[model samples]
Target: MTHMSMSYLSLIVVTMVIGMGASWYVNRQINKYLHVPASMRVTGAQMAEMMLAANGVHGVQVYRGGPQQDHFDPRNNSITLDPDAFGGTSITAIATACHEAGHAIQFAQGYAPMKIRGALVPAVNFASNAWVFLLMFGIFMQLSGLTTLAIVMYAVVVLFQLVTLPVEFDASRRGLAYLKTQGISQAEQGGAYSVLRACALTYVAAALTSILQLLWLLQSRDE
Candidate 1:
């Protein structure tokens, strides 16, 4: 195999390792706190509704999503939680629900980063899927212009991931702060923080992997 092929293969392996490790850590944290009931003992849905009301964020609905699916949709002003998080009173559930609630607050308050990230979604969706195909075809056809364009497209995906970091970290911060103010025990807060932190690492891992992949693409061009 060519040196270029070997280098790319090595990067792929490294990125895969990062992704897998992040996934494992997140799952481990989830399992560790999954059954540890919160002192509040409020259901995840109840916690989310209370958070929304406390923040004066009205008209946003909380709904149950599929397994492992938890997110706040700004488009519809809704928070969706999976079964475990929707009704369970565990630390994991409360943390996840409150974290998503933080996003709702961001939306209501017009957080600049969140707004920018939302604006980029459509273009990022298109670019992320198209870039790899464009890069491969460009290289096969010896078209430098197409290859450069492909790199630019992938850069958008990387930018989105980087923008995501602050948004996520801020959400976790808000969630934790709210927990503290609400008198959640310090030990419970620690467990909740662990869950949120592990989840945030997944985004960091993804961003790092994208950056390395983009760098590899750039390096291969000069080779």
Candidate 2:
């Protein structure tokens, strides 16, 4: 491999290792915190209900949204929690539920960053899928113009990740801030923050990986 290719390979390997580590750690944390018997012990559902009510919000249904990739869907105005997050009393469950709720809150308040991110989702999805074909086709044919278009498309992915930074950060911030004021004990607050931060780290890692890949593409533009 050329020096640049080797550098990219090394960076990608590093990013993957770090990402997997973060995923494992965050998953462990979420599972561990899913059953903590706290002072004001309540199920995730009850807490979600209480929290929403406290904010005088209604019609935002809470559902046991299946397994694996459970998330709150704003379009439906529902907080769909995972099986554990929907029923467990763990810190992970609570924090994740609240994080989803934070998104709901953002949707309700029409947070500009969140709105912009939502708008970009469709375009990014299309670009992400088409980018590789564009790049490969350009390389095989040695078409500089096609290659440039592919690079620009790849850059959209980076832009999407960068735009995502504020959306994720604000959600975590909102969740943590709300958790602090919603009668969570100091100890629980710390644990919740840990869970949220761990989750946030995964995003940061992904963004960094995209950035490095984009830079590598830029460095290859002269080829």
C-alpha local distance difference test of each model = 0.94, 0.80
Off by over 4 Å in 2: none
Per-residue lDDT for 146 in model 1? 94
For 152-180, candidate 2 gives per-residue lDDT tens digits of 99898888898888888888888788778
RMSD of 2: 1.7
Looking at model 1, the pairs that clash are none
TM-score, candidate 1, is: 0.98
lDDT score, candidate 2, position 15: 78
Question: lDDT value for candidate 1?
Answer: 0.94
Model 2's lDDT to the true fold? 0.80
Q: How many residue pairs clash (N, CA or C atoms closer than 3 angstroms) in each of the candidate models, in the order given?
A: 0, 4
